[model samples]
Target: MTTSKRPQNRADWQALAETLIPSLETRAFIDDAFVDAASGETLETLNPASGETLAHVASCDAADAELAVAAARAAHARGDWARLAPAKRKRVLLRLAELMEAHKDELALLDTLDMGKPVSSSLGDMAGAIGSIRHQAESIDKVYGEVAPTGDDSLGLVLREPLGVVASIVPWNFPLMMTAWKIAPALAAGNCVILKPSEKSPLSALRLAGLAKEAGLPRGVFQVLPGYGHTAGKALALSMEVDCLSFTGSTQVGKQLMQYAGQSNLKRVYLECGGKSPNIVFADCKNLDKVAKRAAAAIFHNQGEVCIAGSRLLVENSIREAFVDKVVEAAKAMQPGNPLDPESFMGAMVDETQYRRVLDYIAKGREEGAQLRAGGASLEGPGYFIPPTVFDGVTPAMTIGREEIFGPVLSVFGFDSEEEAVAMANDSDYGLAAGLWSQDIDRIMRVSRRLHSGQVFVNNWAGGDQTVPFGGVKQSGNGRDKSHHSLAEYTELKTVWMSLQG
Candidate 1:
């Protein structure tokens, strides 16, 4: 129990961290038992905030991935999961969600320590994760397949069957919440799942598997393998036996997985990848203050690690300076500090790699002749901390404006007309999400329809309930997460034609 450099407020989380951090089992949870990586390799998980060792987790490779897939297949064949009634599965997941909520504080702490997200923000992420799991569980039995009308002589049926073995590869950012987004629906749809958590943030996902088991989820129906994408994740994608794979991460990695799917048994692959989202504001927006505040939160929240971060500020030329000033004012207030501190709005970058990458992007922005408005330098601390940065006079051709930095960096570009705004927003190779702030219904309607993004937030900057379908268009990747659409992704559509066809 190393609490020497850690920040502790509100005795509960501190106590829980003390209790869990020392006793962490770094081994992968496979077939209901903790085991070492098949390669006998280990990865040391660190507290991104304090640069302290949390645990040395097992790094599962292809061989271990094979073992997990075999277990999942056998379990599905034995009807350990797939044969459960929809209602029964729903109950099991409901209990799982309840257990997760009960230990929300502990889970939130683990999330914060593992990935340098603010303690407060991690707590909110846990709440959302619970809601996502519960929503899917509650809706499992309520959703019904359609029955088509047929001739008097025969009947036609359309049904959705579980896709046997499902594999989920989640990102380091919002690890637990992304896990909930993928696996909850997969479970409710009566499919066995193999969760491959990012090696950088595997603690909460490992704990979640234990919670699922505690809620009476059958053995082999759920398993967690902590490893890198190239080894374990590739194995899942390369497996002919794996029915489907759901992934969340970078677009480059997403494209690689898609190619792996083609080279393998052609398993179904759904990806929610990178974004350089445009947060456009028209002069007609009713609340510039609200826009400035939320827009700052949008780019600086989670250290700007979000896939749908509003990184590009596309403002109308008429009010560009005023809005930029307000945004700069807001960003200057979000200081990166100790993740465990309750008052800290921003936290460290997830690790040194991310920290270096953000610094590199900041340098690039300066080299490309963009105006540096707010904080841009790394903070003096033990942790990997970088202050929120704003760049004005950014051209679409610049690297900062075009690339996904995945850090607290904002690039502002001005447009004179609606056509120019839409053009600049759509010019990027990525289009996961876009945000627009305008009160005019006609303008909102027109721009919302014209944008190529998967989601266009009207008044809000970044937000989505579990009921909404999420995923991106173009290079942002294919398919959808959340909502019944996500639940449906884990099932195979089968149409039964009767004698009427003959």
Candidate 2:
């Protein structure tokens, strides 16, 4: 397959470059400045496109995490940031968003190199990240408390206050976007944040801290600590100084964070975790080819590293074979290539560990009697690359169908009745998100209401607007991330009831 072509000159660069940067800095952002980790340890950032070392990032440890947490705690206690009026806080957030837009190219490049997502997608992510900040900034003052009607001579009211010192652990798949999802709301709500980006893709988070500084955000209000999960992530979760813990990652780690929250200070824990989401396709009224292509893109996008990926495909028996054929054809058309290329649809996996885990799942699927339809093996290269894989004749009990493969692997299963399809989809422990494809309005309404998932997509897959709440049910984890409701997660409500005087 041919790789996507690159831009020739400055004019062509406009299509790809979201921001213009003077230069890319290789450093960590902490305590209001760009600095290296205290330990002086460093890890090499690799370009998955070419399996080359892009740069070296600070290898932070527990000490670094502690420093960041301390900084956040100090900021909160001093009230240098939290004492600001909502409008002033909004101004700071708006400035941060502007800075993010200005630095979009650097952020996108870092994301492409660190996580191996296509540059086009990375640019989109940068834009989304900026929008998230702006959304929360515009929303800060509008979020008001309730005023209850009281008896004569008595006034009753409720007020909302910031939950101080939030430790936000963001995942690698959409590093900057997830960071903004966690940070923008917390900061807008007047809380200090200590962000922990996944070690695999920490560069952008570090760069964002620099941008935050450039935007004139107060010292210690926001700090970025890059380190392994066991050390830095654990410290954040278990820190008594932290008032709330927000995380986006796997189900296993979410459970651990909950435990830490319970043991530490019983602080509020918000998690957006794993998903084995179902994409149900019924023999509908129109456009099977379009549905097939969309299905392929839904699963194959970001190499299927998304938590809401429509991995388990349940199709009606009548059109199963034809749908599978169309999906396989679409998969064959995808070419994993250099992420720097604007046209590349697929790129390498984040790291070797994830690559091996995906390969194991593929092997397990074959051993368990699922027929490999297309693209099962790993790609030949130094970078961790896997082909877009599809498996047919898959049973609900198969490992590939049950587990979150989290790779470019799509499993196809057929069902006869509507009840059977719903049953198959809801069988998993995860209830994050599910996709239903049918032109039948009744079917869409019925299936959407019946599904035990958080966000249900009818005739589409994983398209979220800022106004809508995004989260999951059961093991997929709890607490909404993106809407006006998200502001509630970062706040504490207090009721003031007064007694009437004689």
Candidate 3:
């Protein structure tokens, strides 16, 4: 209805922000119908940018989740999605991707409003999500099953089949992209999916279900349940009929979901959880300037709600002060701006609770005696905005250095050697991801191998694609999200042994 509101320039974006009263669609899609849950309740989804109500989403409950699961089961039993040929499934997903591309700007704007991320960054997220969908769609028919070597009288076949009724609980940080990461492969493998997006940001997921339906995905094949995790997410997890649960959120929540799975049907649970990823800056042969800039970006991107945010910065003692100064300068440039502004590199925190939590961490840093070198205050704005804060002299024991702050706050530590840096980085409850800025190939190889992290970025932080496997280790949770490896999570491998003598 408001195609003209699609911003083409900074001025246009700014104008749209000022005058836009976007009437966002918010409803639970079950059995291909847009309506409320059984209880007939609604919840207000607010714009994180201006703290205004964006949409009133359907507040789905356990009963609604049950209805959705029943629909999915019916669809699966009827051979609507789970029995489709891989190529046909790919076509449906590809069409969905095309539609997503056609309305990318609309989706991007919805995400920006819903989660307080910069509109420019939301566009990137839309691109990533769409790319993920298309790639998984194209890959559906390409990957082949395996043949096993067996005894002389026996033939063995290893076949991969879709695990029916995959339910996902995606986080709010990168809602659309994370949704794509979880559902695309599952759908491509020919499974019905139930997505319960984070209550903090559910608009995009609700909108996405419509796009999927319009793209010709069968009823009940893909459903979006918009509600709190404790309600819909718990209900989906506790269902004995649901086959698998893939989640991306806090480590604590992930562990709880795993318990819920065990308490119910023992559905396979795949979790990609929290991270306090370390960004190690060795006294390399070159490029402190570039690394400093990247370091700043790594922690501050998405207002630091990123699961693999390089929150802990380990700087070689030699370049500590100078590198930190460069980082501080970089942070200064990333000042929080209106989310609708195309030029706003850093926007508000996702919501008020997270905003308060971040501020609490900053206080903890000061109370623990870590030197607050840069920003240590929240920005004066309507929405939740925190200045990019840096804390130097942050020891491993300090709260700032150990915890996943989930804010645009950096904890700086000095490392004497590569081994020490590796030790400090690994000395955490999490082993999700780590990043290093060094030119020595041997050091790079050795440190990367030695670090206890799922993903190691050689010269960058949190950089990769759908082609690469992305996941974490330790308390950061298990299972990969992207690549061919992710496809395995949604499928169960059955070994078929046939006797030739029979």
Candidate 4:
């Protein structure tokens, strides 16, 4: 209710964001209050768009992580949150979702300034985050225990119970949204949560902790720790008190978390990691122009910081050059721009390290004999900006075609047969998601089944709702993020059997 005024335009949003930067909350939220790290260490969170320092957030280490875990453990044991009635817990989460909507603009701006996403796009992330909370809350009371059929004089009961304490480690690409994806279900399952947001974009998660308290969550039930992965992240993963650890990051880091779990309490770990998803275009596709535009957007959107981006484009040989040309034309329209401008279709890289890493991949692409048909260089400015890049004559053997660049770079390949296309698409360490364009229903069904991916989009790209499950296969990591299935990840199943002989 305190947020009575709304920004009317991009200029208003930009101005409001400027006013907010100086006063941004940079402390970690531990045991329901803002506090400094135990080591008194801090890390400067930079505005990737302007290349300016935003604030020095608390750099939580093992000590701070220990404090947060202790608080969460005590809260879970007290049952103030875990033992609350299902309907009451649902009400609290609904209230939290309402508060999120009320503070949507501020939350969106925090992420935009921290990670250099366009404010317009961050607003959409806010919508997704709010919807995620609402959806999980509504399902809390509806999830019911089951009774197993038993013989006479015997009874069996099946129950699902929350894990005691959960630690959510999320990536920066979709900061708030990824946090919501993990915490919503964990909280809905009646578990205390400790969030360790990526250091590159920790602002939004810190802001959400305040709104969570305002929405009537119990003290110590939810907390946020902003720090490096080696310290805070590793501490949580290796903690004996933490019951479950859910992470969305790289495959390399995901492996480390699993190792940490094995070295500690052997707690459950859920991971959603990297991807090299392929978007295939058949010669018999629908409208080439429409597919071309979609293909372009699938890679170039979000400055290509998406985990499931269709970075590899596989086209039939007969139409490969023409389709690549159309895609190049489309990419030209999506050049990087100032993220604060609502009209800007694309934004800067999340930070300097990722910016340089992407440029290195582009260089590799050129050196590996892939043709640079479109933008390949960073825009000259203070911030990290890279335009949409497309490479032609890409082969599976090339470095760019094989790696997950995590930038606005596309590698195009040509295949002569349908079998070759399927083989080429399936030939990768990742099996996250794939996109295909074809009119023949039989071919669609056959190829979709053959492709080794968790989700497949036919005749389009990037199509999915929260109602359906989201995650990946193979090295892409285990566990699902969205839909009813995700709720299962936060809970443990127990079956009780009893017999009466009296």
TM per candidate comes to 0.97, 0.94, 0.97, 0.98
* Model 1 CA deviation exceeding 4 Å by range: 1-12, 500-502
Off by over 4 Å in 2: 1-26, 500-502
Residue 271 lDDT in model 4? 93
TM-score, candidate number 2: 0.94
lDDT of 2 at 109: 72
Please list the C-alpha lDDT of all candidates, in the order they appear. Answer: 0.91, 0.86, 0.89, 0.93
1-502: candidate 2 lDDT, tens digit per residue? 0114544433444444333322445566678877888889887766665666767778777788788888888888899888898889898889989888776776777798788898788888988899889999999999989989887988899999898999899999999999999998899899999998998888888888877887878999998888778878898888888999999999999999999999999989999999999999998737999899989988999999999999998989999999899999998877687676677788889888888899999999999999999999988867888989999999988899899989999999999999999999999999999999888888888989999999999888888777888899999999888888898899999899887795
Candidate 2 residue pairs that clash:
none
Model 3 spans with C-alpha error above 4 angstroms? 1-6, 14-22
Write one digit per residue (lDDT tens) for candidate 3, span 256-293.
99999899999999999999998899997377878888
Candidate 4 structure quality by residue, lDDT tens digits, 1-502: 2346887677887888878887788999999999999999999989888889999999999999999999999999899999999999999999999999988989988888899988888889999999999999999998888989888898899999999899999999999999999999999999999999999999999989999999999988999999999999999999999999999999999999999999999999999999999999999997898899999999988999999999999999999888988999998889888888877788989999999999999999999899999988889879999999999999999999999999999999999998999999999999999999999899999999999998899987878777888999999998999888999899999999999666
Provide the lDDT at 363 for model 2: 94
**What's the candidate order when arranged by decreasing TM-score?**
4, 3, 1, 2
Residue 53 in candidate 3, Cα distance off native in Å: 1.3
TM value for model 3: 0.97
Q: Tell me the TM-score of model 1.
A: 0.97
lDDT of 3: 0.89
